[model samples]
Target chain A: MAFAEFDLIDTYFSQRMEQRDDVELGIGDDGAVVTVDAGNQLVVVTDTMVAGVHFDQDTPARAIGHKVVAVNLSDLAAMGAEPTWISLALTLPSIDQDWLQGFTHGLREICEYYGCQLIGGDTTQGPLAVTVTAHGVLPHGSAIKRTGAKPGDWLYVTGTLGDAGLALAARQRRQQVSDAHYRRITDRLYFPSPRVALGQSLRGVASSAIDVSDGLLADLRHILKGSRVGAKISLDELPLSLALTETLTQDQALAYALTSGDDYELCFTVPESQRGVFDTLVAHTASKPVCIGRITNEAEALQLTLQGEPWQLPETNTGYEHFASPIEPSV
Target chain B: MAFAEFDLIDTYFSQRMEQRDDVELGIGDDGAVVTVDAGNQLVVVTDTMVAGVHFDQDTPARAIGHKVVAVNLSDLAAMGAEPTWISLALTLPSIDQDWLQGFTHGLREICEYYGCQLIGGDTTQGPLAVTVTAHGVLPHGSAIKRTGAKPGDWLYVTGTLGDAGLALAARQRRQQVSDAHYRRITDRLYFPSPRVALGQSLRGVASSAIDVSDGLLADLRHILKGSRVGAKISLDELPLSLALTETLTQDQALAYALTSGDDYELCFTVPESQRGVFDTLVAHTASKPVCIGRITNEAEALQLTLQGEPWQLPETNTGYEHFASPIEPSV
Candidate 1:
């Protein structure tokens, strides 16, 4: 029998979420009900990944599912919030049982790893797109924000950058990489993990933070605009994976790191006094962040240097613009 | 200049939502932070309406915008929760400044009317679709659910049925109607009002509740299945709008009322003792509910009667099933 909406939900999403005491009532109702703990506030974020527009049409269903959750969870991570619950609005052209199984498996894996519950959602028939809304909680007044960065603060970003961009470039035949490098680059593009631990750990340590989904230049510019500060970065300090560097020239790697998108890593700023402590705190983590620059007092412009000399970016290389830029494959 | 994602949001969604104290941080942040008032639980629901599948390709952008919010709000009403905040993930083929204006105008009007804030959202480029995730609040233990009905309760439905269904039939040229009737029926299809006040009033008075989206029979069947009971509905007691009755034959109207979807009215039940008070509570509303039947102990079947005679519906009439049903224009 062809699965109806309800049946599909039952087979895929309904029973897999872990039990949570705060979720008083869950799926199967018109709405899900939960209680927010006394001293914590709720954090809400949403992101939609449209097939063909957000990823390749031939991408694995599991990868699409993982990317959707990871991008939204990355937003929560940027806020220094603990993910608690999520709801999905999935639209599809038709039902493919194999695709559904792979999708659910990926979704379930992320929910389990994050200790988040899938509360409720809607499944509809249409163009394929997955919109995920993630809810997280943080102590009142403790969540980090982009507007908190201050002049003179040190800038840090978790994990290596540009691997996902390199993967995309290679996929589009705009660049090439060896097979060994191709696997690592594609893995980063397809299954980039959200920096949840790093963000949670930065609660009282970072002055401001954001996740790099629109490349380093674009996302850091958002922090500068919001915090009313500028930033000075040394191009040589940008963290690039060995796989990325081995596949392209230094300039090409730098271009990808600076202008390409979909690296779901937390980019944050910390006061000079907190630098030592923050470094030590993140030292043992799998994706320890590295300092690359300092927040500056120049109200609206980003300053750049390469090996002590002034460096200027091409005017068109300012990262992805959803409306102005052509659709590019990314997590 | 072409509208970028950020510019479109700023021009339409950001400054329109009413400021609320509970919203510690609103739009422009990676995630919004809000507090769920103490003593009340949080209710969350999500719905997505795709272009062409949910409505006509040429439907008014304003109406498209209104229906998305209205449908999601109906879910909140069915839970007897007061809406507090909403987040939207809007995907579009491209940005049209005029359409964005009209759409946001419709969204803002509803948000202002219902006191819900558009806290945050993501705008992406793709085939057109709107996904809204609404959050509401209710007293700790007062949320109405489909599982609470009993064998002796009275079944009631708010507002008239069949109008939206008739509208869809006419749109597809399966039925004919006069111009005046066309206006009325299409209005219902495009802009059905959510029974927010009635749902809130039904809090302690209702035994079980569900919003009638997938026709009277289909939605009531959900309650019956959930409550582990059956219902004996009087076919003749169904409330039909004058426009619906004038547009089609009596049998057609009845069939539409029973099998057609998109009538976003509340179908609920109340215990025998609460009937009198419940009637008084809803007496002054714009769409007063009428008693149509009584709940029964027949575990999993729905009984039907028309003017004291047992009636059997044709085998083909059930209701909308996302994958099985044809696309119909609906609010």
Candidate 2:
């Protein structure tokens, strides 16, 4: 017999969620009740991941669970908010107890690490999908926004880029790589670390910020659009992992770095006046921020250069488009 | 050529959301930023409706849209919270512009009516489903909970019961219902007006509260379990609409009222001492509640009575079980 929805929730979800003082009511209630701090504003975001689209149908439950929460948390990181609570709406084609146990274990692990409590959610029968709505809090008027960047702001990205994209390419059989490179790239794809702490530390330092999800170029376009500015990016300055450079040709690696999506790193802009403070702040952080470009007032187009020579974007070098692309398994 | 997720959101959701001052930031940002009043706690709930499961595949898109938001709003009503914002995670097979227009039209109409702004959400390509998470606010510590019921509390239900169940039976061709009865029953299923105002007024009066999504008997059992009490229900006292009573035999209607689900009505308890206050409050409300039972200290088993005689529940008379039961589209 299939597991009943009520019993499954009691067994897998309700007890697994850690308790918090701010949660007056949690799972099992009609709705969860939580209080926001008086001087803070609540930041809410929702993202849905579909099986066979966001991940392979055979992907491990643990990895799927971790990735869903991580991606939504990345949104909070972009806003420079501290995640306080999350709610998940999970739909499954059938009841697989073993899969559920592994999934919840992974979800709980990450949630506990971040001190974010799962307050409530829903479980239903359908094609497998997970929709996580994360809630975070930031001090009033202190949130980093894409609209805050000025023309002279310096663009910086945390950690390396193109690793996840390269991993996806290998998984899709579009590129060949050694076993070592495959492992490293897949690890980056399956277990991305949301730059929550880095974003939090950059609250007052970064002029504008966004998480790199739909590739460097696409997400940067969001920042540019919101701030009503353009940018000039140095192709050679784009961060690349050792595996990425070693496994693929320079041109291929550059394309993946620019257009391959699913990287959860923070791409932020720091105005010239805040550069000194930002540099100092990054020194104490876990990941060093790399300056890759500069914001510009030339709103007509974004300028790309490689070794001080103008470069034209290849026609095929485009970021993931939700409508145009098939449900690619890599992510 | 299909509509991109970006353009679809811009056309259907972003501009249509009513502006709110408390929403410092809205859709299109990394996350929505909202301010809560100092004395209020936020109530959040998420519910997912899958095609061919929550509703028939042929069900109109507008009806599906309306029901998704309505069902989530009912949770807030049960907690006496005033809905302020809603985020929708909509997964679809492909872009159908006509369907989308009707669906968003239905969503916008309700949000505008309730003054709940569409804050932020996700749109992904996948199987047809909608996961809506609603957020509301209430005075701190004033929300009604199922655990508040105690021995000697009277049970009351808002509106009628069994209409949706009967409608579902008719749709499946297991029961025959006249066209007039069909129209009324389907309407009840599609558009349930959440008792937000009544719930707000009954905040201090209700000892325990829950929305009747899984039939009267099953949902009331939740209250009994939470409060560590049992209940004695009078079958004759159940409030049934004319259509239900006229369409089904007496025993059939009784069984439906007790076990059939998706009523979206509130069932609550009021302590004996607050009877006078509750009665007075209900008199001024739009839907007069029906007193159907009383909470008892018999914690082991619930007692059922029909016309003052003991009644035994049939072994098969159980409420909807999400995993085990077939998708009965009338939800």
Candidate 3:
């Protein structure tokens, strides 16, 4: 059977996700009409994933769908906004019914979990790729920016890191792991949980915030540059998953935790006055927020310490550059 | 020199567009935060264009950038919304300086003309493609929908049609045209004008509205199906450009006008009771609205007439299908 564009959308996308009262018009219109509450502001973020560049052919279609939404949602989480709606622009080399089924299922699963509705989008024939533009909402003055940190702030991060990097290394045959550990590590790489609730909880508490998509050191640099402050982090304070610690040495695990990307955990800063309140509030959350360092008055300076001695960064301190040579799965 | 993602965005996009008060945070952030007035609703639209599918290698980069923004704005125009902000998710095979210069120049030109600002977006390395999600705003209850047409509503279309189809045919060597006319028609295809002002003026007047991106007959069918009302259109009444009329026979021109896509004009319906007011309101507009049809009580039936006699549709009545085999240049 030939599936035309409209039929494909009707079969897989329309009427599949939950509808919200704010969506006056959803699919099947030239554009969608939605309302933002009286005192709320709209937050918009977009992310794109390509076939060979972002994922390998062996990656499941469901994982691709989930990752595209997850990455965009992670950005929203960084902004301390609640995900509300998403528009997907999907491109495919050909029509594959099974792939479409799995992709839509994954998309629906995450959107429903986040209470976001699939508003509308475009479907085209091209290289396999998907671009998701997510819409979020928050109170008018509650947005947490990267430029809000100050000297004497306490730096923190949610959840552990380095598992995703170790997972990719295993998948590429650079490392070996047992089946059970491999499953745990790969699950971290595939289905990253965006810290949506934690981000919201830190809206009034965090002095500055950013999602760790490009390694802990690299992402922390953004906060330092934006806020014009410095940070001193202890490598021993870096959080690591059991899968990563068991598979690699302490030094190797620290390297991955500091330089590897694809960890969707939130890296944030809290002022000294609010540290106690932040710790108390985070104690009840699912992910235990870990304090890693403190902010300094030195502008754009990042100091690292291992044990009790000062440490040096690798010769190449760059993070994941999108156009850098020898493409690897970064996001 | 390596053009990293951050460098590319900062050099080309960050400082180019106009800054607006409504945008609390623009580029360089995880997400953009924008305000919507208390009495207004948001209109969102997304469209994607791919290389080899939307345009050939001979197409100019400037045209690609302009067309992508124009198509999304056209959808907003159909919804009777004022264009405000846009987010772009661009994927490129490689970094070409000249292409980026021309593309950003074109994008900035059109955006400045429409008073729309570029907020934030994603850039990735992949096959060449661009997805633009545009946001617009309108009064809370003034959005013109596709399901609001009623019996005795007069259908009207803005500007002319079929020139873009003829332009494509000429470019493909399937048709011949004079050098002067070729530029005129190709300009129609490349730099389509989204009827932003006219669409805004149509608020509360046009019962239903849609943009003509998938040919006239195919797009009109959407309104007919959604409104559950039939239409009677006169083929001879379809507005044709001078270039199209002089290049092809009347029958061929009418056929192109009815069946070709990428016109980017507005098709709307006004009730008979408000016809006088609509005519007076449209008389002061740039694109003179032309009456070509009237709504009927018969459900989902479209009757066509040429001169005074009943007309029949061609065997293949479908519009541009995104996943259809034998890829063609489409927006």
lDDT against the true structure, each candidate: 0.87, 0.87, 0.88
Candidates ranked by DockQ: 2, 3, 1
> For candidate 3, what is the DockQ-based docking class?
medium
**Candidate 1, residue A144: how far the Cα is off, in Å:** 1.1
**DockQ of candidates 1 onward, in order?**
0.70, 0.77, 0.74
| 2 or 3, greater by lDDT | 3
Task: Please give, for residues B1-331, the per-residue lDDT of candidate 3 as tens digits.
Answer: 3457878899989976977889999998889999999999999999998988877778899998899999999999999999999999999878888998888988998899999999999999888899999999999989999999999999999989988888988998988999999999999999999999999989999999999987898899899999999999988889999888899987778778887888999999999888888989977788998999899999899899998899775546455557653336442
| Fnat per candidate | 0.77, 0.81, 0.84
- Candidate 2, position A189, lDDT: 90
What is the per-residue lDDT of model 2 for residues B237-311, given as tens digits with 9 covering 90 to 100? 989988878977777888888888889999999999999998888887778999999999987368889999987
TM-score of 2: 0.97
| Minimal lDDT window, size 10, model 1 chain B | B322-331
Best by DockQ: 2
True contacts kept of 2: 0.81
lDDT of 1 at B14: 84
Candidate 2 lDDT at A70 equals 95
Give the best candidate by lDDT: 3
Error of 3 at A173 (Å): 1.1
* Model 1 agreement with the true structure over B164-277: per-residue lDDT tens digits: 988888888888888899998899998889998888889999999998887788888889989999998998898988886776667777888887889889999999999889
